[model samples]
Every structure is written in C-alpha cells, then in structure tokens.
Target chain A: MTILVKIFGDLRKKIEGYNISDALPLNLQIESNGIDTIADILNKFSIEKEETYHLFVNGTYSGYNKKVKDGDRVGLFPKNMSLLYKWYFERNEDE
Target chain B: MAKRILRVDMTKLEANFENFPADFAALGGRALTSTIVAKEVDPLCHPLGASNKLVFAPGLVTGTKAPTSGRISVGGKSPLTGGIKEANAGTTFAQKLGRMRIAAIVVEGKHEEDDYYLLKVTNDGTEFIKANKWSNKGLYDVYKELYKEFGDKVSISGVGIAAEIRGAASGICFNDPEGLPSRYAGRGGLGAVMASKGLKFIVVDETGAPGVEILNEEAFNMGVKKLTNALTSHDVTKPGGALNSYGTCVLVNIINEAGGLPQRNFSSGQDDRSEKVSGEVKAEEIKKRGGVRPHFCSPGCVIQCSEVWTKPGGKDPVGVLEFESVWALGPNCSIYDLDVIGELNRTCNDLGLDTIEAGDLLGVAMEGGLLEFGDGKGALKMLNEIKNKTPTGRILANGTAFTAQAFGVTRVPVVKGQGLPAYDPRAIKGIGVTYATTPQGADHTAGYAIATEIMGVGGTADPKDTNKSDLSRNLQLATAAIDAAGYCLFIAFAILDIPEGLEGVVDTLNGVLGASLTVNDVAGYGQQIIDTERAFNKAAGFTEKDDRLPEFFLKEPLPPHNEVFNVSDEELDKVWGT
Candidate 1:
C-alpha cells in the first residue's frame, strides 16, 4: 500500500540526509500486507517512538494508533506545532 | 515605590508626571488602557477629534525577567470602527517604559495647530519637540532620524504618512530591537488618533531610570524559574521549536491543509500555491538567501518567531515577516510571490498602515474589479497608490469595510468594520464565534479559538463545531488577562499545557504587585477587562447587531470543507451571557 508523507520543522533535520523536497508531502509506497497504524509506518521510516511529533492523516490530525491506508496523506510535525496550534491536531478524535 | 504616569496635554503643549492613581494601581497593559479609555474618553466623541485620547501602557511583568512578556498596549476610540480599541505590540519600547516605572503615557486634547510634534521622554523629563521636519516621511526614515537624535539605546514610537493624513487604516509604529519601525500596535486606526493629537514620535530614553519594584523577590524568582522551564522545555517555545526554526509562517501549510486558509479575497479556502508560500518554503528561502531566521522582535524574547526576510540576492532586507502578514498579503490577495508580499509588507510598515487591513482592502478592491486577482505587480502598484495617496489609495486607506461599501462589493469578509484575518470563519467555526462576539471587532487574538479548534491549546474542539461560544469566551477572558499582564500571547501555548507555567505567570504578577491572587482571580481579572471593554463598546452605541460576522459568511459556502458559518446569532449573543 502507498501513502503520501510530509515532515516539517525539526523533524526534517531528524531524518537522515533529508532532502528539502521531503518537507512537502510525497508519496511513499510502504509494503503493507496487513492493516497498520500510522505508528507502524513511522517506525518503518526509522522514526523513534519517543519522538515528540504530531501526525496528521489526510489533512486531519490523527493518533499514532489510527490506521493508515493506501493513498492517505500523512503529515508529521514536531511537538512545537501542537502547542503553537493549541493542541488541536488530533482531528480524528471523534473517529 | 509608586508607579508614575506621564500625561501629555497636546492642546497645551505641556507634559507633566504624576503618581499613578491608586484606583488604577492593579491594572497594566490592556486592562489599564481599556479601563482608562472606558472611563475617560466619551464613546460618542469623534475618534479623530479633541475628545479622544491615546493611552500607552506596558504589561505588569514587562520589565521583569518574564520570558516573552514585553508587550505594549495602545488604546483609543477607533476612527475606523467607531468603537473602543486596544492594539498591542511586542517591542522593547514597553520594556523601557516599565523599567522607568512608568505605568502609562496619556496623550489628550488635540493641538490647536496642525504642526507635528514629538513627545520625547527620558529619565530626566518629558518634552515636546517640533518634529515638522520629518512630517509625511516613512516610519523607517523617521526612525533613523529619531535614532540619530536620541541614540541607539532610546526606544522610538511614531506614525507615518498615513497617520499624518489621518488615514483610517493607519497604525502606530514602534521600533523593534534593530531600531526598525516594523513593530506596530496595528489595529483600529489608533495611529490616526495619535496624529490627530499632532504627535508624531514618542522617543523613550530609560537611562538612569529606576527599574520595576518587585513586591516579593522570592516569589518573583520562583515564578521566573518556573516560566523559564516551561518555555525552554515546551516544544513550541523551546529553542528548536517550530516558531524558533521556521517562524510563524509554519501555520501557512497547516491551515491550508485544514482548508481554512482564506484565499482570493475569501472566495476560496484552499489555494494550489499554498505550499509555495508555506512557512517551510519561507524558512528555506531565508536560509538560501542569507537572511536572518529565528529573529526576535523585542529583547528577552525566547520564542523568536520573527524573521528578517531578504530578496534572493540579499540586496533588499525586509523587516520581520510574520505569519499574518504573509497570509494577508500573499494568499488572501491570491499573490503567492514572497518577494512581492515582502515588498508590500515593507510598504505597509513605511506608510504606517495595518498590513491586515491593507491586504483585506486590496482583496476587496480586487473583488470590486479595481485590480486583477493574483496580480502581484498590480498589487504593488495599488499599494504605491496608497503611498502616493491617490484617489484609489484614499479609498483603500480607509480599510476593508469602507472599500467594500464604496465599490458595492458584497463578499466583504469583516466583523464590526474590521476585516477578518487569515482564517476563513466559515471553515474554522470555533473562531467564527470569536470573530462574531469579541469586543475587539473581528480580531483573532481576542479569543483565538484557533488554539483549541486547530492547535488544541486548552482542549480539542471540532473545527466545524458551532457550539464553542463558551470556549471562545473563556479563551477571550484568559487572553484579556494575559494581554493585561504584558505576557506575549504565545505564552498561552505553554501555560495551557503546563499547569505550573500558568501558576508561574500568576506568581510573576503576585511578586510584582505584592498581592495574593489565585488562578481563579486571574480569570476574574480577565473577565473584568472584557466587561470594561464591553461597557465601553455598549456606551459607544454598539449592540447585539455589532457582534456579528458579515452576511456573506452565513450565506456563502467556503471551499474545500464547503461549510458556511453555521454558528447562530443567538449563540454569539450568549458569548457574553447574562
């Protein structure tokens, strides 16, 4: 399954050899034979579990445990954005 | 030690220092300004006439070690909106005033003659200097001349050509750390009020001035320590936070993604060129262009969400490019060219205009077919018209609502005569309640429900939820208190998530005033400020009708989310419940 991913702010530097273009969301086809959460995809990208980042799937803030399907637009932001935006990121809370 | 107040009677051309009134002792910043304006200035008095007064005050902890707490409040009856107004700016001028133990500077009674004057304040005394030489000049030039006369250490606050002409869109400009007149108490045409008094510059020299007297030294230290920890530890306020790294422009992408970024004069919520103008792109460009990133507007600011943007070759240096400035000039006008936005922002500063109002007016003008949408060069040309005070410029200089009325454009996005900011209220429904109900006339910072609805500062509320009147009111109250305290509103981000940080803010106030106030008391203080402002607005002939989003918002559906401002007027009235 393929999903588009974007990273911003400190997360860009955290990524190894991060290209500037990576800041804008680009498609990533991750092998997902089984259903997986955003956390799983982040882990596959070598993102540390303890890292303070906000995840948004399909333009809405999503929990790490939220499922990530193919073609979902996932955005990763540092913990700074959560407070900057007043902790409003978890858009899928109702879901 | 008693605080001092400087009362400058422009009518008499005399300045006097007096003891800060015991009745107004507890107040500072917005609370002080609003309270004074509410009590002193007649609501029905013409804002540009002799009856209106301009009051400048620093926050309680402005001169202290409170991180990001240096903000100055400028309050007066608004010429643009015909309502009470308090516009704030984060500049070293406030800190210098606080250090001098000056509670407020009150400018009253218009000068009989039209000759411009400068109100110069120092530790020695205050004087009115004939400043006609700098009349009708850009603030940047005025700042340079003032800096040369007063020295680099002195703080300068002045108006520009727009204010000299008493343009309704004019704002009082203050010098930043770099002595650039880029920081502004930019709202409600307060600059015009200042100019009406025949005052052009307020140069503050704090040398040999006594610093603020702390009531409780121990509490103050503890409060500073707690706040420092919260600010440093928080991801947003910390050194490597989004603001420090990318500056405020970071929100451009997020808001665009949320489908709330106002584009093309509120005709759309989303723009295809959103990524091009995002903070990420700006930051990247700044880095590539050898511009200064992570710039601080005032001294002792830890967050430093300000930045100095320059042209690609670094030939032309644009003063701090803020998120709102970028959004207003870039996306709302359908112009994504950063250079053009930068130039327009610089022009707004030079002309002593509020970029938000100026950009909104341009957008409305575009809607009126006066200019083509997405024409960056054309936008620049129209701005030049404003600088030259052309007929078209005069109309635009009056601000968004006025321009709309003149052009017979119905899609004007404004509340109470003030233009709506970057976020389209139709999509960001929580903020819509705030825009509709705030006494400040469609100001985002009045309640800032975007924190909860989008950023989740206090608590998460669905962006589409119209049942956020209570949340908006609470945030508005808290913000009032924060504004009064002179703490940068950004501190709310840290204090909201960190309970101790909130306590630290309260403790700072307690230490400064030597009073024991609980967290609940702060809320009460904020409520009192709101009540005072509301009373002033009411006395000024404002009613339930004034607290409303324009009709277009309710009837017209915005793009992406395809949502209208579904918040009911009854709910908006309930924002200030009986």
Candidate 2:
C-alpha cells in the first residue's frame, strides 16, 4: 500500500534528503497495517509534532490520529506557514 | 489643530471647512461614514445621481502609532447594491487624512458640466483644479504625473476610465507608499458616485499638518505596546509568518485544499491546477523575478501582506495579486497562469475597476457565450472595451448580475446586486450566511465567518453547521467595530486569541476619545454602526428577501464536497433577528 504525502511552505526545506526538484507528492509505501495513522506517517518521515501546524487528510482538515490507508492523500503545513492560529491553538488546548 | 470636516459642494464648485461635530467626536472610519450617510443622504436617492454624496473618512486610531491601523473608509449609496456602502482600504492616503486632522471629507451635489475637476487639500485650505486634461486616462500613468506635479508629499485618490463611464464596478483608487495607484476602496461602485459628482481626484498634502491628538497618552502607549506585541507574536501575523512570507495569497493553497476555492464561476470547488497559482508558487516567482514580497500597502503595517507583482525579470510592477483577485481573475475564470492573472490585475488597476467584480463579470461573460473559459486574452480585451466605453464594455462594467442578465444567464452569484468574493458558499456554509445576510451584499470582509467556521475561532468550529446565524451576527458586529477602529481585519486573527490584544484595542480608543470604553462596549458600538446602515438599507427598499444567496448556490452541488448551500432562509433571516 502507498500513501501520497504533500508538504507545503517551509516544510519542504526541513525534510532531510527530500529532492526539491521532485515537486510532486511523495509516495510512502506502507505495509498493510490498519493501525497506521497520520502521526505514524510523520514519525516515519521524522517530522516533529511542533513542526506541523495544519494537517489535511483527503482534502479535509484532520488531526494526527486520523488513520491513513492506501490511496489516501495527506498534506502538511509547517508552523511558520500557519494560516489560522486560533483553531490550531484552541484545538490543542482541548486535546 | 482641531479636527474638522471638509464639505465639497460640486454644484457650487466650493469647498468649505466645518468644525467636527461634538456628537461625532468618537466616530471615525466606517462608523462615521455610515452614520453621516444615514443621517444626511436620502436613502431612496439615486446612487449615481445629484443627490448622492461620497464620503471619505479616516479611522479613530489611523494617524497614530497603532500598528496596522492605517485604513480609510469610503461611504455612499452603492450603485451596485443600491444600498448604503462603506468600502475600506489601507493606504498612506488615509494616514495623511488622519494626520491632517480631517475627520471626514463629504462630497455632495453633482457638477452640471461635462468636465472633471480635482480637489486639492493642503494644510492651508482646499482648491479645485479643472482636471479635464486627465479625464479618461488610466490611473497608473495619471498617478505618476500627479505625484510629479504635486510633489512627493501628497497622497492621491482618483477614478479612471471605469468611473468616467460611471461603471457600477468602478472603485476609488488610492496610492501605495511608492505612490502606485494600487490601493483601493474597491467595492460597491463608490467610484461611480465620485465620478457622477464630476470629481476626478482628491489630493491631500499633509505637509506641516498636525497629527492625531491622544487625550490619554499613557493609556495609548500601553495599548500600543500590547497590540504591537500581539501582532508581532501571533503565529499567523508575526515576522516570517504566513502573511509576512507569502502575502494574503497564502490562502490560495489552503482554501483550495479545504475544497472551498471556487473555480470556473462557482461551477466547481478545489481544482488540482490551483496549486499553479498558489501563494508559495507566487512567492517563489516573485523572488526569482526580483519583485517585492512581504510589502505593505501603507506605512507601519506589521502584517505586510501586500506585494509588487512584476513581469518576468521584474519589469512593470502590477501591485499586489491578492488572494481574492487571483481567485476571481484566475481560477474562477479557469485561467490559472500567474502571468495572465498579473496582466488582468494590472488592467483592473489601470482602468480603476474592482478586481473581484471584473473577474466575476468575466466569468459571467464566459458563461453567456461571449468568450470561452480560460481565455485570459479575451478577458483582457473585454477590460479594454470598458476603457474604450464600447457598448459591450458598458454592460460588462455594470458588474456580475447585470452582465449575467444581459447574456440571459441564470446562474448568477450575487446578493443585493453585488458579486461574491473568493470563497465558495456551498462548502463553507457559515460564509454562505455572511454572503447572504451582510448589508454590504456578498462582501466576505463584512463578516469573515471563515475564521470561525473553518479556523475554529469565536467558539464555532463546524463548517457545515446550518445553525450559523448567531455566528455570522457576532462576527459581523465584531467586524464593524474593527472597521470603525481603523485596524486592518487581519488583526482579528491575533486579537481573538490574545486577550490583552482586545483590551489594548479598547485602551487605544479610550485614549483617543478621552472616554472610558470597556471591551463590553465594542459590540454595542459595532451594533450602532450596523443598525444605522441597516436602517438606511431598509429605507432604500431592501426587504428581508434581499438577504439571500442566489438560487444557484442553493440548488447546485459543488464538486469535491458536492454540497449545496443548504442554510435555510429562516436561518439566514435569523442572522439579524428578523
């Protein structure tokens, strides 16, 4: 199974060894593990929780705990690229 | 120097200075404009007729050291909406008016002559110059010539070919810091009201002018410190933040990803090609072309989201390609290339047309079989027709609804005769409520429900929540207060989460007015401004039925989400408790 991952803004520079020339979405081949969530994908890529602000799963705003399966699309935006700080902070407080 | 109002009577060709009314001591910006319009102008008067009055006002904290507070409000009966309109812009022109101690400039009576005139206001007095030589020219060239003639110390506000023809899509153009004719009070066709008065431009020279007076200096300082801290510290507004790095166009990718970015005249939401015109892409292009990014529309703005979009290798700057401008002109018309969008934006600036209205009208023109979608060159030609005052140009310049009716198209995206902004209401239901119920027609800034509906601010989080009447009401009230205070609406993102920031705003107001106004009074102040405008709109024959989105938005299912704007009419009417 493969999950398509897209990184936006300054997050592109943060990922180690990621080719900037390859501007298309990064495909991460994942074994058939039903437990794999967005957090696990971030962990696989070594992206810290603080490094990401907005997360979208399949074009819908989502949380780190949302499960990602094959053929799913996930997009990540960095903290500096944060568009809506209130929602990010408020949702964090609730968590 | 005591604050005063400049009353310019076009019929008599006279300019008079009157002492600022004691009753209006606390009013500025949108508050002052709406109040004066409601009190003086007959609501039923023709918007572009002799009876209409065009008002220009600076905000309460405008000329002061308040960060990001340099905003001006232009108010009058809107030729587009046929309702009371107050359109705001951030520019040094506003700051100049504020420093000059000119609270408001009311332009009344229409000139009987066919010639145009320019009103020149210095610290000494005001003079009228016959400006027929500058009539019918594009603003970009006229602005440079005016600056050369009047010198660098002056700020200008002028109309262009669109206003010369009294186009309903015309907007009042102002100068940026570099004296570029880019900043604008760019909605509701207030420029037509100015043109109908035969007033081409109003130039303000603030040389030797006395600045705004702060009654309570200590409170003002403290408030400024807190608000500045909030703006500089907030993740979304601070240095290196989203706005600072990519400008307002940063939302191109964000909104597109959320499945709310309208494409091809609201026919679809969220196209993959939208990334081609994303803020990140634009920033990269601006950097490569040596264009200016993270630029400010006015001096002293902390959130410098404005930029200069230049052609390849950085020639012929076309000012900022704002998110709404890019969306309306690019993706909404199925034209995704930034270069094409830049030229369209430049033409809009040159001709003094509202980018949103022009883009929406172009989309309608496309649907009406005037041209094919994605024909960027064709769109440019239509804009030129407006410049030439061709018969087809007249219909196009009247705005989206009128253009749609002319073409026999029924899928019109307008409310109160004004075109919708960038957001697609079908996906974001709360903003749909705002587009439906705002007295200013389909203005997104009238009530930016996206902050709460999408971003989870102001206690509402669900985007699809149909019961958003209360949310829209609260946001519209807060927005009115912010507009009156002269702070840019972007500041709301910081102040909403930062408690001290909100307090700081009230403190600054109290410092300026020498009257104690708690945060509790904020809503009431906003309510008063809105109530005044509502009364004017009600008197102007706008019934509850006016507060509605087009039928297409209700029935058509937008792609990606495939959701229609299902917020019931009852829910919409509940926005104002009608």
TM per model?
0.94, 0.95
lDDT by residue for model 1 over B321-402, one digit each (tens)?
8888899998999998888899999989999999999889999999999889888888888877877878888888889999
For candidate 2, what's the RMSD?
A: 2.8
lDDT value for model 2: 0.87
After superposition, the stretches of candidate 1 with alpha carbons farther than 4 Å from their true spots are A13-18, A21-40, A48-54, A65-72, A83-90, B449-466
Instruction: Give the clashing residue pairs of candidate 1, or none.
Output: A85-B455, A86-B455, A86-B456, A86-B457, A87-B455, A87-B456, A87-B457, A88-B455, A88-B456
Q: What tens-digit string does per-residue lDDT give for candidate 2 at B1-578? A: 79999999999999999999999998999999999999889999999988999999999999999999999999999999999999999999899999989999999999998989999999879999999988888888999999999999899999999988889999999998888889989999998899999999999999899899899998898899889998899888898888998888888877787778899988998987888898888988899899998899988899898999999989999889999999999999999899999999999999989999999999999999999999999999999999999999999999999999999999898999999998888877777888888889999888741244322234464433435787787788878888998999998877876878887888999888888997777777877998999999999999999999999998889988788988788988987888
True contacts kept of each: 0.32, 0.37
Q: Stretches of candidate 2 above 4 Å error?
A: A19-35, A84-95, B449-466
The numbered model that scores best in TM-score is 2
